[model samples]
Target: MYEASDLKKGIKIELEGEPYIITDFEFSKPGKGQAIYRVRMKNLLTGYSIDKSYRSNDKFQPANVSNLKLQYSYFDGTNYVFMDPETFENYSVNADLMEDKKDYLMENMEVDGTLYNEMVIDVTLPSFVEMKVMRSDPGVKGDTATNATKPATMETGLEIKVPLFVNEGDVIRIDTRTGEYLARVSTK
Candidate 1:
């Protein structure tokens, strides 16, 4: 249990049987009336945002949330498996929760995973990942135009644009957030 005055950004609480994390918060007093707590929160289960105002007497239930550093194991069709490096325990996340993130995950890579009420909810991958270009067409001769790029297929099946100079069997760094090419890391 927490009092309204205790609310702060990054705090997790339960509302209507769902867990929410406060993304922004502010405390205000009207000089005469009671204090109010304003908060902007995101629903952990549905990824929705909402705003609410609470009176000084309002109380809240603290949500049970935990984070772990887990290593990628494999996708088991219905769920993505991750292993606790120190304990050797496995946690499975629903495949739907991994949608776009699967492209950036590599075998045995370490990632931060968030669990709410013991249910896996969120995963954070590295900012940059090194991926191998499995196949890419040769750059056109004399096509020296600035910022020129060609299509490429990565080992994970993520299609991205790489500099014309890049070719098959080359390892490149990718910015996971934007899914953009950073630079060629190596050539095989």
Candidate 2:
């Protein structure tokens, strides 16, 4: 159990019998009123977000989530499959659960998944991933005059804006969170 006064960002709690992860929180004490907390939270299962306020003394049950390191095995159209390295157990999660991170998934790559009551809620991919550039136009000579960027397609079928120097067949480092190009991995 946790008091509203102790609420902080990233803290998970139960509200109305549903699990919500704190996305943002603010502590306020109005001039004429008692201390209160304004919080923004996202539903772990559905990804819906809402804002609510709580009085300082209000209490709520803290949600406990477990994380496991799993490997990307395959995807069967509707659901993506993952394997637990330790127990060799398999879990199939919906595409919505993976969201934009699906583009970064690679076979045998290590991924982190959050579980609540043995159900997977979220998946976290590495900060940076190596991907092959599948398509891009030729860069104009002397294009270094500006920091201009062009769109490039990756092997995973995700398109990202990269510098003009990028070309097809080049492997690059990509920041999965922002879906941006980090740097060219190699020229060849």
Candidate 3:
């Protein structure tokens, strides 16, 4: 259980039997009213967000959430499959649930799966990933007049802008959180 005073960003709590993670929190004590906690939370199961307010005396149940280390197995047309490295148990998540995350998933890649009530709700990838550029146009000579960039397709099929000097068959580091190019690693 958690008191209103305990509510803060990243704290998980149970509401109506559903798990929610606080994404934003603000406490306000007006000149004459009771202290109120304004919070914005995301539903772990549905990927929905809501804003709520509570008084200082309110209490909430703690959500049952756990993180499991799983490895990406494969994507079956309609769903993405993951397997527990140790137990070899398979978990399939709907493709809709993965959204843009599917762009960064790589076979055999290890990731953290967030479970709510023993059911997988979300997956977290590494902050940075190394990917090979599958296609990129050659940069024109003297194009270094500024910080120029060109579109490159990654092996995963994710398209991103890379510096002008980047070419096809090059390996580069990418920041997964922002889907941005970091630096060139090697040329193949």
Candidate 4:
């Protein structure tokens, strides 16, 4: 349980049977009355944001959210399946929640899965991943301008800018957060 004074950004709480994370928080005390807490929260399941206010005596229940290390199994037409490596329990997350993160998913890759009320709500990829360049154009011989980058397609079907020196069939490191090329790993 949490009191109004305990509200802060990043805190998760339950309201009306739904879990929400506090994205913003503000506290104010009137000259004569009690203090009020203003907060903006984002729904853990639907990715929706809402604002609400509470008085000093208000209390809230903590959200039942847990993050588990799960292995990516496969995605059927409707859901993305993940499995607990130790227990072998399977979790199915809806496609809408996956969004663009699906591009970074690889078979047997480990990811952080957020579960709320015993249901999977979100999936997160690692910070960096190694991928192969599936296609790229030849770089011009004398075009060595500073910060020059060329377009390259990765085997995962994600297109990103790579240094001009990168060529097809090369394995390279990529930053998952920004979808940018980091460095070359090896040439095929």
TM-score of each: 0.96, 0.80, 0.85, 0.92
How do the residues 111-152 of candidate 3 rate in per-residue lDDT, one tens digit apiece?
Answer: 999988767789999999999999998988887667788899
What digit string (tens of lDDT, one per residue) describes model 2 on residues 4-115? 9888998999888778999999988889989889999998877899999999889989876778998999999999999999999988988887767888888998999898
lDDT against true structure, model 3: 0.92
In candidate 1 the C-alpha lDDT for residue 165 amounts to: 94
Candidate 4 wrongly placed segments (more than 4 Å): none
TM-score, cand. 4 vs. native: 0.92
lDDT of 4 by residue, 119-143 (tens): 9988899999999999999888899
lDDT of 3 at 154: 96
* Best lDDT among the predictions, by candidate number: 1
Could you tally the backbone clashes for each prediction?
0, 0, 0, 0
Q: Write out the backbone clash pairs for model 4.
A: none
Off by over 4 Å in 1: none
lDDT (C-alpha, whole model) for all candidates: 0.92, 0.88, 0.92, 0.92
